[model samples]
Target: MGADNQFPVIQYVNEAGSLKQDEVKLHKEQLYQFYFMMVRARMMDKKCLNLQRQGRIGTYVQYEGQEAAQVGSALAVEDGDWMFPTYRDHAATMSFGHSLRNLFLYWKGRLEGSIPPEGRNIFPPAVPIASQLLHAAGAAWAEKKKNSDRVSIVYFGDGATSEGDFHEGLNFASVFHAPVVFFNQNNGYAISVPMEKQMKSKTIAQKGLAYDIPSLRIDGNDILAVYHETVKAVARARSGGGPTLIEAVTWRYGAHTTADDPSKYRDQQESEIRRKTTDPLLRVERLLKNQGWWKEEEKERMEAEITKEINQALKEAEKFKPADIDELFDHVFAEPVWPIEEQRKQHKRLSREGIQ
Candidate 1:
């Protein structure tokens, strides 16, 4: 594709796997790392789906096709940076040093999943749409006040753009010149609601213009493009250039979540067709092939490594103690309210009577 003519669709590699070297500079190591992370994300997604089916996890949101968008932007941030992710963005969190066990524990409904590893600034996945945007802006603004160099990156869905928090966050960030990257994955739907029905704007990136923020829309499935663009955004923030909004034009090949049926709201056949041209991993594989880095042995080795890593994490997660019901009330407040105390007592009484 003629990328220059397509102002917002910056792509370094074509769907056929052909690379446009003039479009973006990349090293073999970076490409390989992208491939590794994408595969790992896919594996984790598949495993999570199976776990849900087996009743090992609660409802889950799958991000199989958007691996490139998640992993690329995730890898672009510094260790000190903050990450605000939605329920579908565990891949991004895991890519940024989050423990795989903790992620799985999250799906199992454990509070431990919310805790970030030491020195890692990762937040629990947000289920309330677009709420994280405000958190990201607030944290980044705080960082600026402390005269720290840390930036914050927030991820949201195309559907989230419609929320009031989205606009409020953008406005706050722009007014404060906060260091936040509003990474939007325009995956075409909010549940069954199509993008056209969701908004009238020509593009999500265009919405940033109203806030006087720098914005760009890119081929989110193109890992190179995502990495390069996010790196620039982060750099700009670090240098006090303020916030940016990046709309990653991507897709989710699976159902909105394991709980819903895609056929009920979307054309499943059309999704199958998207696998041909817009599948993130296939494009990266094509890139690898063109670079002469595609090897059967390497592929097998990577799969084995991923399998081992996931299995180990799964074991650890399973070995964890069952979550306490009281934990639900504990974290919400420093001191329990009367209603909460009464409920806790009721539960305790029920437990003693073996009726809980």
Candidate 2:
């Protein structure tokens, strides 16, 4: 059997929102909390897309269809645990205590956006693909050396598995027994390239096997499954069980970013079909309804509260003065190199002359 067939997708909830696994018992409050986070993530995603379209923010990445994967995994980690998110992982970051106003500032190209809240170990969103994997591994190793219980969780897309850092990070983690979770959101595409065209490997989880790290493929749309599986991996890491690779099978319902057009590569109909059948939020809604806990009035109130919060964050983000262009050159080095200084000067000169 191929890796795809070999690694069965783990799921706690089926399409009908019924619990498939009796072993995993979830309380009513926990389910409500998960449902709220998923709804908040979806609303934030939609708001960001609108902000990008209105030119209020720069190119934005949407995580509409992957809310369960992001939110569930984020909630699995504790207060001091480290989080390394990608450009498309705002949902995860936000769930992990990242401020909404700062998230807004990030898309506006402000340096302050990268700063996490006090006491939060959230790293700036990694724009350079799989590079954060190494950073996460190194951090996890450092924590292990310090004999701390804190583990690091690094988020990346399926495309990142093709990068050298992905393999190196996994190998190093395996060899050193780094306390890290290699979380891969296999959204079926690496930008315009589908997973099949990108790699011959049947599943991303199989790649971890070569490194001798325990790995599993899970239904990313099932929030409960993602949370429970992640909790297990994190516990193992804390207990010196080394690392685990998780492949979250999910889909993105929008363009790779606001700058790219999905219609150029795949059928838009596929997204529509998935939205109807496998939407993460819809699944949670179904579960709530099945339990007779879903209230339309409560949902409406939640929507209103979330919208108000997002609008307030936007206002706060907009209140900041425009960022200094020199920030780009200054943060690259402790002391500016001659070339950087010269470039900064030249940029200032051009600005003084009102040149575009």
Candidate 3:
């Protein structure tokens, strides 16, 4: 059988929001918490897109349609766990307790934006493809050597799986039994490239099998499935079961970044249709209604509250003085290298000449 046939997409909730698995852990209060958290991340993502267009921030990476995959996996980890995120994975970082103000500041091009909350081990968003996987693997290996219970979770895309670091990270993790979760958000496209065009393997999960890691494929739009399966992966890693790879079969309904036009390469109608049929937020909303647990007033209140929270973070970010240009050169290395010193001097000279 083909890998796709062998690894069926798992889900605890259908796209219509109907519960498929009657697990005891899917209680009322916790489900509501998950709903609220996803909503917060979604709202923040949308607002950041608007902020980018308004020239209030720098280029942004939108994660509009894959909230369940990011949020569910984020919520599965415990405090002190490590998270290495790609530029598009802020939803995961935020759900894992990154500061909203810092997130805003990040897009505003301030170094402070990279700082995680006190005691939180969230890494700065990696703009480079597939590099953070090594960081995650190394950190997890470090924790294992210390005999600590902490595990690391790294987020990447379908395109990243093609990078050598992805394979190296997995191979190292598998061989050394690094306690990490390699979470792949298969959003159907690597920017303009589709999955079929980029990979010959029928499924991303099968890639993990090559490294001898336990792997699973799950519905990224289903929060229940994402949360439960991720919880299992985390538990296994924590218990010294090494690493697990999860390929979240999902989609991104927007541009790869604010700088790119997705419409140039793909049909927009598919996104429009998928928003109705497979939006992670909509699926959860359906589930809530199906359970008779949804209230229009509560949803409205949640939206209003989240909007206010986003606004407060925005205000705090805007209040900062423009970042010093030296911050860029200084942070590049512990001591100034010749090239950096030359660049810093050139920039300062340009500023004085009003050419900046």
Best candidate, TM-score: 2
Candidate 3: C-alpha lDDT = 0.92
lDDT by residue for model 1 (158-187), tens: 999999999999999999999999999988
In angstroms, the error of model 1 at 218 is 0.5
lDDT of each: 0.91, 0.93, 0.92
The candidate that achieves the highest lDDT relative to the unseen native structure:
2
Q: After superposition, how far is residue 177 of candidate 1 from its true place, in Å?
A: 0.2
User: Higher TM-score: candidate 1 or 3?
Assistant: 3
lDDT of 2 by residue, 193-296 (tens): 99999999999999998999999999999999999999999999999999999999999999999889899889999999999999988888888888888888
Off by over 4 Å in 3: none
Candidate with more favorable, higher TM-score: 1 or 2: 2
